[model samples]
Target: MFGGPYPWSLYCGQWSILPPAPKGNYLKDKVVVITGATSGVGLEASKQFADASPEQLIFAVRSVEAGEKLLGQIRKAHPNLQDKVMYLDLTDLQNIKDFSEAIKVFGRVDILINNAGINPNFDEGPYKSTKDGYERVFQTNVLSPFLTTLLLLPLLRKSSDPKVIFTGSDVHHIAPSDLIETALQNGQSIISAYNDEGKYHNPTRYYESKLLLQILSRNLIKTLPDITTINVNPGLAMTNLGRDFNLSLSPSGIVGILWFVANARSASKAARNLTSAAA
Candidate 1:
């Protein structure tokens, strides 16, 4: 079910259509922090986690208003849930540090789900760089998350069973290794290669970024021996990650169609895997 014809076999199979998260207070007394919780799998994962009844569920989001709205909806459904939304702009390094510092009030975070990501349509124009001078995709998808995880290591270690979940992708396997090798051979860092506008490619940039994220997460485990750091592919789910793609005869639009087709699961259903990982 997991491996076969590209996305179709995975989409048609049972992996995409997951059962609802089992009802229980498995997360009782635990504190969970999730990024990108206002939409996509992160939004659904928040709801599912609420059902499991954690002591506190904090959502690290860029938009406090949107996070609050989602928190209200979840609270309305599960009145007993204790949740709050905090601002986290992945594009800015200082912002991520400030967000981590604010999280110190919670004392410890049992599970950290790095679920927020972006896949910009490179066809739109030249790649943009973050204020930190890194490519937007690389910053948002790889660097930011890595930095956040590092900053939160102290708080995470306080948990008896601390775990970090990185939302990875199957597409990572197809990342442009030629560029990566060429960059490394020239003494250019991966970040440098990504920032080079001359080498950026549509869609594949996202794929390559995911690959880098996966690699980083694996290495992170060595630094965090006690913490259960994992990277999980939520499979292809319809999410705002493809918000930039518009349907048309254009290359990006065609990729968007494939994205829609491959994403056989709803965000809610796909989130089961994430919540399950926390369990």
Candidate 2:
């Protein structure tokens, strides 16, 4: 059941028995950077890394205020956590470039975790595009992360054993291909295809984006053999991911809640996968 055309071996097996987080101060001299560290899996991964005692931990978040608040909470427990929170809005390509340049102050990045993502509810309205003229979800989940990794490659290469990690998902296996086929048939670029409001499908957008991300991660492995690139499937987790869905106490919201209850694990537990991959 775990291994087939849709191989769940690596995904399901790992979820069933998550790798143990490092126990010692192994990251003493390493500079680790994580995006979306103020919430959900990102927040928990930040905490886990903090406990491990990294030389430097940077949180690339959308809000500096929220990042700092999270840092304060972490400091309360560790009392000596060396961390900084910087603003990084994945919705804007320019903002991602600016954030990457700002990271130069840290010199080198040993671990870069592109953990931030979004799943907008298509049920609410038609597809919306970012200022960069890409679909909001596509830009946030795929393009921005790809750009961040590209910009940070030079710094990551400077490290002895630099690693780049993407928080992928299992749903990618079930993502539809008809959208892509239709895009190709119409001779539209991948970006333009996804940006097309007529072609927008809520159930498939996130899955397709993640599938694309995993594909990119694999290419990184081949092209950048020196850097250890991995796409980690964190499994379903109960986080603020659905905050955009605006799930109130309505009938649909009740169904959404039930879906989470049956399928999603706690964010803290799910975050172990991220930390393990980073370690």
TM-scores for every predicted model: 0.90, 0.90
Could you give candidate 2's per-residue lDDT for residues 191-219 as a string of tens digits?
A: 77778888888756877898888778889
151-189 in candidate 1: lDDT tens per residue?
999999899999999998877776668777987899887
Candidate 1: which pairs clash? Answer: none
RMSD of each: 3.2, 3.6
Model 1 regions more than 4 Å off: 1-20, 122-124, 249-259
> In angstroms, how far off is 237's CA in candidate 2?
0.7
lDDT of each: 0.84, 0.84
Off by over 4 Å in 2: 1-15, 122-124, 182-188, 246-256
Clash number by candidate, in order: 0, 0
